[model samples]
Target: MKLYHSVDTRSLRCVWLLEELGVSYDLDVVPFPPRVKAPEFLAVNPLGTLPYLVDGDTKMSESVAILEYLLNRYDGGELRLTPDEADYGSWLNWMHFGEASLANIQATILRYTLFLPKPQRLPVVGEDLSVFLQERLKVLDAGLQGKTYLCGERFTAADISVGYALLLSSLFGYQKYFTPAITVYFDRLQSRAAYQAARAKS
Candidate 1:
């Protein structure tokens, strides 16, 4: 298996999970916004999206989907919650929630605040996004109030999925709005050996 990734992007989620699963895979670190910085990558994936994975004949792009694929395909079932598990629904919800809800807001904020040129940057839009993000974070903070992981005591793929959004919050300077529960949860995630390894390698 091989993964095309960009440091600090959603691709880190896949790298983190791969480390936790102790799987042997190739990591191709590419420049961010690959369509511009690495035009050659466009031939491989027309979308030029990061977190692209190629495993034999299988290919994937979405970060959360790639995590599920890795778990199911690489004999990493230990980190997966089956359909019969009580927390399965919650697990799926939180996993997709991280990217669909949190990261989507973060990306928009980035576009308005940093990605665009100074003259194009919109302070009002960035501020509104920050407020919106804080409101969304409330759900995550509440969900983590009494649990070590999103689903429960076990460290599952859901944590990796959500943890990447938390990681993005910190990197993008929105962590100031992180609630107490979120702060503790992010700290726990950062302390993991696999998380550390993924960070160093990225």
Candidate 2:
């Protein structure tokens, strides 16, 4: 197995899961915005996106989908909640919520605030998205009011999926608005050995 990743990108989700599963895989760290910085990578994945995975004949791009693929293909039973489990629906919902909801807004804020040139940067747009992101985060904060993890006590890939979004919130300077519950939850996630190991590799 091999993964193409870039520092602080969504690929961290996959790397963290690989560490948690204790799987052997090669990490190929490429420059960020590989589409422009690493033109050669376009041949490997036309999309030139980060978090690209190659496992034998299988290849994946979406970060959350990669997590599911890794869990299903690698017998990651310890960190997976099956369909028969009571919290299965919640688990799947939170996993996709991280990227589809939180990261989507965060990425737009990033684009308006930093990625775009100074003349193109729009503080008003970034501010509006930041407010929108906080609204989304409030839902997560409420859900985490009494749980150690997203699916109650079990530390599954759901945590890893959402955890990366929390990490991104902090990296993008929106953590100052993090609610108390979110702060505590993110602290717990950061303290995990697997998360720490993945950070080191990133």
Candidate 3:
């Protein structure tokens, strides 16, 4: 298995999962802004996105999908919950919650606050996204009030998925709005050895 990745991107979540699973794989580091600068990488992933992966014939792009794929294929049922598990539905919800919902808002925040030129930047838009993200985070915060991890008593890939987005949000200055629960959750995630290993790579 080989992973095409960029630092400080969602690909780090996959790398973290790989580390936690103890899987051996090659890392193909690509410079940021590859879509315009790296034609060879575009050939591998027409979307030119981070977390493009090729595992003997199974090619994938989306970071969350790649994560699920890795867990399904490599893990011995530790990082995920099966359909029989009581927390299965909640697990799936939070897994997609990070990427599909929070990430979209984060992208908008990045576009207005960082990517756009000062003349074109919209602080109001960024503020609105911050509000949106904070509102969404409330759900997670409430859910985590009594639980050690997102799904249940044990840590799972659901934590990896949601944790990655939460980590990025904090780095992007979203922590000011974080509830105490979220702050504690983020700290616990940061304390993980696998997360540290992935951070070193990032």
Candidate 4:
């Protein structure tokens, strides 16, 4: 297996999963945000996105899908809640929520507030996204009120997915709005050995 990664990107989740699985793979670190300009990286993934994975003849991108494939193919389903599990539905909901809902707002906030040039940056738009993200985070906060992880007692890939968004939000200075419950949750996620290992590799 080979993972094309860049520091502090969504690739963090994939690398963390790989470490958790104890799978040996080559980590190909590249410059951030402009993988398209690198000819070698472009050959591996035409779209030139980070977290590109290759296993023999199969190739995958998108951190969430890659994680799903890895857990199913190699983890004996240990990293997921089976359909019969009590938190299965909640797990699926939160997994997609992390990316589809929360991540969209995070990217918008990054673009408007930090990544865009000064003249192009718009704090007003960024504030709107921040508000939207805070509202969405409330749903997660309520779900995590008395739980150890996103679903229930066990830690699964769902936590990794949502946790990354929370981490990114903190980096964007949105942690002040993080509910006390979620603040504790994010800290717990960061304290994991796998998270620390993956971050060190990045």
Candidate 5:
């Protein structure tokens, strides 16, 4: 598999997953600013997003989907996904919430703060985002109250995905605004081996 990636982006999720899975493959790092719009890239994903993967001719986009695909298909090989099964109903639930709800909240903040030009950006956007993120983070904190990983006591690719999401909040300077338990959760995710590897590459 070949991964097309950019630093400090959603690509970190795949990088962490790759490290956790101990997969050997190729990586094409595209630096930021003008970003990657190579014709070859568009051929893999018409949307032209980073974290695009090409496993032989099987091209895939979207970080969450790719992580799940790699884990399920490759058995997460070594740092394998726990409670491994053909049926991943419970695992998918946590992943869906993190991808759909948590990512949406963070992406919104990114757009308003990072993507939008300062002159046109709304300064008050943080207040609105805080309401949703604070509530949502508490839910995640409650879910992890007695657990080490998202699905249970063991780490899985879901943690790689959601853990990267939490790291994103920290990178964006949003982690500190959350509750204490949430802050500690973000810290642990930051300190993981796979996460550190992804950060170095990113």
Candidate 6:
């Protein structure tokens, strides 16, 4: 199996999964272009995004899908989070919340920082997004209350999927609403040796 990776991007999630899974895979690092428009890259995915994966016959385009694929295929090599995990119901809920809430946070950040020109950038929406992210974090903070990992005691693939987005917020220079538990959780996620390795490569 092989994973195509990129540094300072969501591909770190895939690399983090690969490291956690302890699977031997080669990485092909592709530099992000200033303007992401290329026929060859677009052929891989219409969105032309990073963190793409290929395992012999399988091709995965999203980080969450890739994380789940790694978990099911490798028997939870490191982080055993499966949608059908022993804690399936809750895991599934976190996964859905992660996708929906994080998507809004990411899209809003991009529109202000990169997607829009100086004159076109809307600070109002960015401020609105800041409020939205805070509101969403409260729910996450509550879900994480009295828990070590998202799914109780053991670390799982869900952590990698969601944790990667938190890392994104940090990389993007946001440091406003990190609570004590969230801080602890992020520290735990970062403390994993696999996460360290992934961070080095990323």
Question: How many clashes does the backbone of model 4 have?
Answer: 0
Among these predictions, the greatest lDDT belongs to 2
- Model 1 stretches astray by more than 4 angstroms: none
**lDDT (Cα, 0-100) at 107 in candidate 6:** 62
> How big is the positional error of residue 19 in model 6, measured in Å on the Cα after superposition?
0.5
What lDDT does the true structure give each of the candidates? Answer: 0.90, 0.92, 0.87, 0.84, 0.74, 0.75
- Model 3 scores worst on lDDT over the 10 consecutive residues at 31-40
For residues 27-116, what per-residue lDDT tens digits would candidate 2 score against the true structure?
999998998899999999999998999999999999999999999999989688889988889889998999998987899899998999
- Kindly report the root-mean-square deviation of model 6 from the true structure over all alpha carbons: 2.4
- Residue 82 lDDT, candidate 3, scale 0-100: 88
Best by TM-score: 2
Off by over 4 Å in 5: 33-44, 77-88
**Candidate 4 per-residue C-alpha lDDT over 18-84 given as tens digits, one digit per residue, 9 for 90 to 100:** 8888888999888877454476777778888878989898799898888888888787266787788
Give the per-residue lDDT digits (tens) of candidate 6, residues 1-202: 7666678676787798888777899887766741253446666666777767878889887777787788788787546644444677778667656656865487676789667879988888788788888888788788899999898777877777778777867776654577788888988999999999998984
Query: How close to the true structure is residue 159 of candidate 1, measured as C-alpha lDDT?
Result: 89
lDDT of 5 by residue, 147-177 (tens): 7677566776667767766777777887775
TM-scores for the candidates: 0.95, 0.96, 0.94, 0.92, 0.85, 0.87
Candidate 2 residue-wise lDDT at 62: 96
C-alpha lDDT of residue 122 in model 3: 95
Instruction: Name the lDDT of candidate 5.
Output: 0.74
User: Once superposed on the true structure, which residue ranges of model 2 sit more than 4 Å away at CA?
Assistant: none
Task: State the displacement of the C-alpha of residue 21, model 3, in Å, after optimal TM-score superposition.
Answer: 0.4
Q: Which stretches of candidate 4 lie over 4 Å from their true place?
A: 36-39
* Candidate number with the higher lDDT (2 or 3): 2
